[model samples]
Target: MVMEIVCPAGTPAALRAAVRAGAHTVYCGFNDETNARNFPGLNFDRSEMREGVDFAHAHGARVLVAINTFPRAGDQSIWHRAIDDAKLSGADAVILADAGLLDYAARTHPGLRLHLSVQAAAANADIINFYAGTFGVKRVVLPRVLSVPEIAAINAETDVETEVFVFGGLCVMAEGRCSLSSYATGLSPNMNGVCSPASHVKYHDNNGELDAKLGGFTIHRAAKDEPAPYPTLCKGCFSAGGQTGHLFEDPVSLNAEQLIPQLQKAGVRALKIEGRQRSKSYVAQVVRNFRAAVDALEAGRPLPEGMLARLSEGQAMTTGAYKKTWR
Candidate 1:
């Protein structure tokens, strides 16, 4: 079977765009802290989620609700309610990370399909099989840390389907495990879903140069006319090991469209796009292009070239760790 093309939809409008652009699946989150991507002016409320699911189903696409963040010590009910709301909204599945929460859902909502989120970082077959056996997780979103050969090896050892991020953005650290943001700004991708949030960003004129500061830390400093990337701590240039450069990653977006065949050969069941915080138009374009790529692959045709370069951030793209050299 052809791998499913799953796209992110941060808003109702983006959901519609993704469906229209031929996404086989659309993943979104409720407008609450229960989700990892809980940014302002994004995500859907309960009614909007219901309507969005209905619309996507009408268009022959599935909706996956993301309740991927870890629950606070005393606020587990919010995440539980969000999962219930997703089921009521007719979502096809719920992506999750926390082990306790997975156990909770398995016991309470046994009928709903559960996909382990990338945030869980279930990279090896042993851990993935453990989750499957323990919580009945049907699929696992493989973290970006694995190389293609490593992924192939994992597939040979497990029956649970694997999903991979094929395009848009890259996380240098393990997803949902990095606390650098919280350590810096008291907000994090796992806790608050905002990394180097705009609220804490400051740009100053550094003597005819531009300095982008995040949480009082200088992330990027360059000539005023030079393009400055966002102050994401991972992509930030810093003096490390007696050198100053992008220590974690260059300001590049992931563009692994060309690896679809290899991913398929590695036993991936779905390809995920990772730009929930993007615009509706961007979502539509990416969904359309990726849809075309998957369709071509299914038909045994050549893949399209540079269909999304103009849309890439910083006009640069990377294959990420999917290639062995990224390790």
Candidate 2:
């Protein structure tokens, strides 16, 4: 079977671009805190979501609404409304992370398809099976912490479809559990949907050197002519016991294009691209390249080479935990 190409569409224009670029499925979120990538100008409104879903379906593509953030106490009405709106918007599925939200979705919208988000950190077979048996989740987006062998082991034990991130931002911590951003900005990524939010980010020019700070804490510094990475907490430069560098993780994006066949062998059903905050043209280019690669694999042809290296974060990429190199 051809691996499904799941692309991100942050806006209505990006939705059309991904579908036209040959994405089998495009995932997006509403312009609120219910989704993980809740940036200021990204994501769609209610009317735009309806139109985007209509457009994707008209082009023979599917749209999955991401209602993946954890709901705040005494304020679940917002999350519930998001689920209702997603169903009313003609979404093919709703990706969820919180157990309460999943339960609500399973009970309230019995006919709606549910996908387990990576934020749930359903890494093992038992949990994946639990989510499937309890919530009737049809698919689970595996967290980026698992190796190919680990994924294959989980696939051997569960019937739930597996989706893996094949490209874009790499998270060092387990999804849905990081507190660094919250510690710095008093906002949780899993709950508030903003990490190192632009509102708290500032840059300083110190004698021809630039310092990038997140929530007033300096995260990275470089010469004026050099590129400085965005000050995401995990990927930030920091001083440890004796050294100062990227103490947690380097600013490298995941690029598993070379592992398509291996991931397929591991029983992964879908390949997801991260970066909903990207431009429509970037989304189109990534969708096109990934779609072509999957098509080639289905036809038993050689996979394309060096097609997306230039698109990687900081112009560097890694296979992440797929190769188990960190161990």
lDDT of each: 0.89, 0.93
Clash number for model 1?
A: 0
Q: Show the colliding residue pairs in model 2.
A: none
Q: In model 2, where do residues sit more than 4 Å from their true spots? A: 205-208
lDDT of 2: 0.93
The alpha-carbon root-mean-square deviation between model 1 and the true structure, to one decimal in Å, is 1.7
Of candidate 1, the 10-residue stretch with the lowest lDDT total is 222-231
Error of 2 at 46 (Å): 0.6
Which candidate leads the pack in TM-score?
Answer: 2
What local lDDT does model 1 show for residue 265? 95
- For every candidate in turn, the CA RMSD to the true structure comes to 1.7, 1.2
Cα error of candidate 1 at position 217, Å: 1.8
